[model samples]
Target: MAKKKKKDAYIDPQQRELRELIELKKMQQAAAEHPEEVQAEFEKEEPIVPKTFKEKWKNYWYHYKGLTWGGLAGVVLVVWLIKDIFFGPEYDLSVTTATKYMFSALNDSMSSDLASYAEDYNGDGKTDVTYNEITIYLDPEAENVDVQMNAINLQKLMAVFAGGEDLLFVLEQESYDYVCGGKEGIFIDLSALYPDIDIIEGDKLILNDTALGKKMYLNGLEEDVFLCVRDMGGSVKEDDESLSTMERSLDFVENILREEYPDKFPAEEAPADNSSEEAR
Candidate 1:
């Protein structure tokens, strides 16, 4: 049961001030020893230097190595273009060469198809005889020297083969009132083989016959020729007698050409009334 007495503490302001001053001096001395450390700790951080356009471009180039090559490639292409403009494959616009190339392409294509057919004569391994018919057409408006040559070449071939014969070479020229129009041309009617036959006014043969008139229209004679000889309905097999007849007819025609019109072989003529009737 004893009461405790509170002890009064005595404070010294000068001593307290002195202690704070001493602590502050120590901090200053430490800071003075390492100025960079104080600056790094207390100083505001400097903003980073912004990249220049050129430096940025360099960085981009590094990222995309292909871009550098692409620029070089563009320069190389420009140089090549310049070279070609001044010097390139000799600009060949010769009519003769053009004509030659056109005909050569056409003949080559035809020959290739025929060769294929010849190789595959029968379903069995046997060689069957096959004939190729090439028909050329000249456009009335197409006046290139090459086109003329093509027509001439076709005519010559027909003359050489046809002589004075009944062999069919379909060359029908559309008549122009005063001057001959080249609108008319030859066609190989294969409607029998292909039912959808369309007679177009060009050298090429349209392969389908059933599509005739639907896609393209045929002339009267052309339809007859297609229906009579070239179609599946026509007799493809040439018997010995028929072949012999053809040979004789061709020979006779050749003789007639030689005797009558020596210049125009396989020349066409109006049949005599009796002869025409007999022919029909």
Candidate 2:
């Protein structure tokens, strides 16, 4: 049996263990040499996900939660544009105006007149035409007495451009200049609109001029405001092609003042103080 002790080909246990350790050392070296590749492989095996809707909204709100007035003004502009585009096209005409005092009287009179009045465009005995729709906004020329015209936000001014309003009553010269832009076509020339009337004052339109039939001086205001039509003569109704919005506006306001209170005329001269006279 011992004649040739079976020739056995077997590795020692220590040698096998040493071989495994060497393989492990090689793997460690490879991993060390390409750490980013190893990390990428790990990520591929288990990837991260995006946040939920509520989390995103909360993050967005946090971004704009502390915006200033100037930032808010931009938001207002965006909102105005959205509303202008998405809203109904039923409005026949639009007016953009500023001043807290002037708008009150004008808005009241306009709303009343629109509900009760109609014009006979074709003169066929029936004045059953859609009255021009007028919208008024309470925008101010300046935030305060010290604020410059350029410093103002002019949201309502831009609204006119966006809404395509037919009429604009401007109380601030800075806004007027911005809209007109040095004889540009944002506003129709008063001279062209009314050749018979004279509103030009050295190449400028005067608000207190008699061309508007009578001065539309609102009470309690220190200055006068100007009125002008849009450059394109925007109108909502086909019947309004011939109808003059500028002329109608002047007539509407002047006629109301004349018919309603003929006593307030000349507006410059108040009745002599009768009590003072009697006392004298």
Candidate 3:
């Protein structure tokens, strides 16, 4: 017996996991053999405690995905709102035009002519003028043009029709006729606004609708396309100070037309002086 000395068995720290696994397997085998005993033991053990709100939230974040995306979207929307409110560009005025022909030529001419016409109407030193374009398609029924006026486009059309003090529209012939058909509020009487406009001058482009009580400038190139300006929302009063800006803009338009399409729109001719001709 003295000669028989027990040798200590050494186990590595990493091998402790294997020993635990074997112990678990033995327990599982015992539980399978005595299911009733294992069930009673499990029932006797304390029930799992409910997770706190913080712990539950941590678990939820570990599993759920849409909530994280929703949070990010909310943050982006808030930032956009702040930026729009504080740093958004402010337009002194907006001009809307409807064209039947391709606008490339007219656009080039306009851009070249109006390049230096930017004015500080609001005394803000920045020129905030926006040019908007609308394409008109001929309607099959009435030989008039039709626009897909739905959603945002419809809202924009209505806003221009409403005639805001800072907004103007240069409408096409068929479009102008359709808008002025009701003569409700879509057009501002240019004659009333500028008594000296000479809209019917020979060298000037003009169109008349006696029934509709409207007269405007026709496109020199296209007979069916007319040019006319109306206050957006038609709310510009005769005595409004902004009328001066409107006048200047209209004059600018006339000058551009006269310059760009000189062949089509020439200078007005001087009337012959028949009475003075006898002295000659």
Candidate 2 local lDDT, 157-201, one digit each (tens):
455456553453444454466555686655556565334434342
Of candidate 1, the 10-residue stretch with the lowest lDDT total is: 91-100
Q: How displaced is residue 239 in candidate 3, in Å?
A: 6.5
Off by over 4 Å in 1: 1-103, 106-110, 119-137, 146-151, 157-161, 164-205, 208-280
76-191 in candidate 1: lDDT tens per residue?
A: 99999989778653311101111112223334443332223223312455333222344344445744446765677656544533332223232223211111123222213333
> What number of clashing residue pairs does each candidate have, in the order they appear?
13, 0, 10
TM-score of each predicted structure versus truth: 0.23, 0.36, 0.43
Number of the predicted model whose TM-score against the real structure is largest: 3
Model 3 misplaced regions, further than 4 Å: 1-85, 100-113, 123-128, 136-152, 184-221, 231-234, 237-245, 257-280
Give the lowest summed-lDDT range of ten residues in model 3. Answer: 209-218
Error of 1 at 205 (Å): 6.9
The lDDT values for all models are: 0.39, 0.49, 0.55
- On TM-score, the stronger of 2 and 3 is 3
C-alpha positional error of residue 231 in candidate 2 after TM-score superposition, expressed in Å: 7.5
